[model samples]
Target: MLKIEELQKRIDELLLKAGLPRHSVNLCTAPVGDGTPYISFENGKYNYIFSERGYEFFRKITESTDELLYWIMSELAYKIAFKYELENRIEGRDGRRIAFPKFIELMTKINPLWKLKAEDEIKKTLSASPYDDSLYL
Candidate 1:
């Protein structure tokens, strides 16, 4: 079984590799009876909510660090892309987004595994939570 402290360290290391600040994303487990995944950002930090299933996914993914890193890149990049899209929608910016693509590119650079896991594959991994739109982006 993986300890939370070690899990936190792997996350922090990944963030630092991506040139992001440690604890910039607060990783948390969902409460009992609340297994649906969720995510939010405020106070300059991302609240990454993980249900029991999500945590298990993390544990399983860790056996292969490349897979773990790739998954993290996908989720974080997608979340950032969603944030930009939401902002653009609110601000009525031009319907052009260069950032999202670059975000994915950076993530891929950090851990190149797009051929192994596409966006569709990511969607297939998570449950049918209403939060999919935000999470899968």
Candidate 2:
């Protein structure tokens, strides 16, 4: 299982890698009731809430520190990307579009290292795990 301290450390590392300030975001886990994870920006800080179901899902698939780190970093990428859009007034195609691809593209342009590192980390995690049959559950 991934420890909370370890997760926090990984999150901090990701923030550093993205050139974001440490105080820009807060990561926490709680019983969110909806079984869905969410990110909220308020008071100049981003609150990332990982629900109980999300925690269990990570615990089931993340067998190593690298895998867990990859998972957290990926989520951070999304949150940071969205935060950037909101800050810069970058709107989506239909105003309600997911914009993940655009975010990834923007992130890649901002920091080439992130994409390369994320790819390596994901490849390592997938190779180490081989298969996860609980994806449907």
Candidate 3:
């Protein structure tokens, strides 16, 4: 299971280096199929797909996709609590049995500013979310 505390620390460090605040990110999650792994964010609104396979995929991609490191970190952070929930097999007590938005929320807070090479698909993904707007602004 991924440690939220450790991941958060790393995020904080990244934000410090990026010269951004730490309140811009607010992680939030919602139900998607049996499980989902798509990351999304809007103005004060956040949604992402979550699943075990998604986590594994992230781990694999993050390992080799250093260019997408920030996105990978943000994605991993949001999934931390969810990972814990799954690892512990804890039941949903407060409607968050599987929801873990704090991770991405942290990223938004840090206001990560990354330089993503302009590619149709990448631009579409980043622009589609509030991430690029927040980062550039």
| lDDT of the candidates, in the order given | 0.51, 0.51, 0.42
Query: How would you encode candidate 1's per-residue C-alpha lDDT over 28-56 as one tens digit per residue?
Result: 54434355333333443334345563353
Task: Tell how far residue 49 is off in model 1, in angstroms.
Answer: 7.6
In model 1, which runs have C-alpha deviations exceeding 4 angstroms?
32-69, 85-100, 113-137
Worst 10 residues of 2 by lDDT: 90-99
Give the residue spans of candidate 2 off by over 4 A: 29-60, 83-98, 105-137
When 1 and 2 are scored with TM-score, the better candidate is 1
Write down the TM-score for model 2: 0.43
TM accuracy, model 1: 0.46
Off by over 4 Å in 3: 27-69, 72-137
For model 1, what is the C-alpha lDDT against the true structure? Answer: 0.51
* Per-candidate total of colliding backbone pairs: 0, 0, 15
lDDT of 2 by residue, 1-105 (tens): 445665677667666766767744444555565545543334433344555643533222334555444445566566765765565542323211233444555
| Candidate 3 C-alpha lDDT tens digits along 1-137 | 22334444555666565454663343324334344444343333322335563342232233222233355455545455466556655342432323333433444444433322212333465456533223322
Which rank order by TM-score, best down to worst?
Answer: 1, 2, 3
lDDT of 2 at 118: 53
